[model samples]
Target: MQTSLAKSVTFNGVGLHSGAPVRMRLHPADADHGIVFRRIDVIGMQNRVHATWDRVTPSKLCTLIENEDGVTVSTIEHITAALAGCGVHNALIEIDGPEVPIMDGSSAPFVAGIRRSGIRFLRAPLRAIRILKPVEFKDGVATARLEPADGFEIDFAIDFTDAAIGQQSKRLEMANGAFVRELMECRTFCRQADVDHMQAHGLALGGTYENAIVFDGDKVLSPGGLRRPDEAVRHKMLDALGDLSLAGAPILGRYVGNRAGHAMTNRLLRALFAQPDAFEYVTLDADQERLLPGAGVCRPVALAG
Candidate 1:
């Protein structure tokens, strides 16, 4: 069955790049609504931007979606990941700003909000984009690929020169609340030098030591350090799931990312759809539905990263 939120939930925070304070709400929608973002601040023209792969436009360091009328929303990955991980297929997201709030630089807050709001299963049947063959996209050293799998899974690897976040890899089956338990609390990470460079250029204005994990050479500048030893890679997988959700349906496949970012994953989705034979939409059987990312997930007593 398809699922939507039982009641509306709200979030307030500042945009990571723009540093503007923002308010956003997630409301339940009819089955098949997928996920749509409405820019309430836009006075006229088409304000609704569908969260689909084709609507994705290149942005710096975050996933961005734009409408034909030029309305855009940036830094949506964390919220979208929360939705996907909660098994939410239909939602109407209304925001009064151009960017989704970067709440704690991770999807945990969103996940908690969704769980609190509760999930309402729709009467409509659930469907998923099942990978039929391998589809891959590469940009220099970074790559993203989707291949046949019984359930959604992620294999990601990252190698950074910063000793605190040096080479790390992780693979996980996303079903059975694995995302909430293992990935949701893993915050975004960046090198201290990169943070300095981006800030000097007037970017990441809302970033603080509390939200993102800041690594300075051999040390972690973030106060609490990592929630898990392999947190960086797990956060990458969290991002990949959020980006993959842009396919506009649940996906049943194995996603492999080698230092892949938002752009590479979006390109991989384009590649997957470009070749019709690479994937197909299928109505999910009960057994198959049980294999998806958020099957049977309930509000967590405590989040583990």
Candidate 2:
């Protein structure tokens, strides 16, 4: 069955890149609405931005979506991940600014909020993109691929020059609320040099040690250090799930990402959808539904962890 939130939930915080304060509300929508973002502050322009891969623009820093009228919203991956992770398919996300909040640089707050609001199941049967064959996209050292699988799985590998975060890899079957329990709290991280470079260019204005994990040479700059030793890679997996959610449906496949980012993942989606033989849409049966990412997700219990 499809699902929507039981009630509206609101969040307030600053954007990691723009540093602008924004308030966003997630309202339950009718079945099959998927996910749409409304720019409440815009006037005289189309304010609706569909959270789809086709709407994705080329961005190095974040996942951005723009409507035909040029209304855009940035840094949407975290909240998007939370929605998909919680199995909320029909939502109208309203934001009063150009970017979603970077609350704690993780999807924990969003997950918590959704859990509090609860999810209501609809009568409509759920549909998912089932991978038919291997589809892959690559750029230099980065690559992302999807292949036929019984359920959604994620495998990620990240290598960084920083000694504190050299090389890490992890693979997880995203069933059974694994996303919320194991991955949602992992925050975005960067090296001190990258932070300095972005700051010199007047970017990441709202970024501070409090919001993101920062590392310098061999020292950890963020207070209390990392929540997980391999947080960098786990966050990468979190990002992969969010970007893949742009498919606009729950995907049943094994996703493998190697040093892949937003742009690369979007390209992978483009490649997958462009090839008709690569995938197919199927209505899930009751047993198949149990294996989907949203199935068996103990929202309240997962959030507690």
- Evaluated with lDDT, which candidate comes out highest? 1
Candidate 1, 98: how far from true, in Å?
0.5
Per-residue accuracy of model 2 over 146-216 as CA lDDT, tens digit each: 99999999999998888999989999999888998889999999888999999899899999998899999
Q: What is the lDDT of residue 170 in candidate 2?
A: 99
lDDT of 1: 0.91
C-alpha TM-score for every candidate: 0.97, 0.97
Off by over 4 Å in 1: 299-305
**Candidate 1 lDDT over residue span 1-305, tens digit each:** 88888889999999999899999999989888899999999996999999999999998699999999999999999999999998889999999999999989999999999999888878889989999999999889988899999999999999898888889999999989899999999999898889999999999999998989999999999998889998889999999999999999999999999989999999999999899989999999889988988888844232111
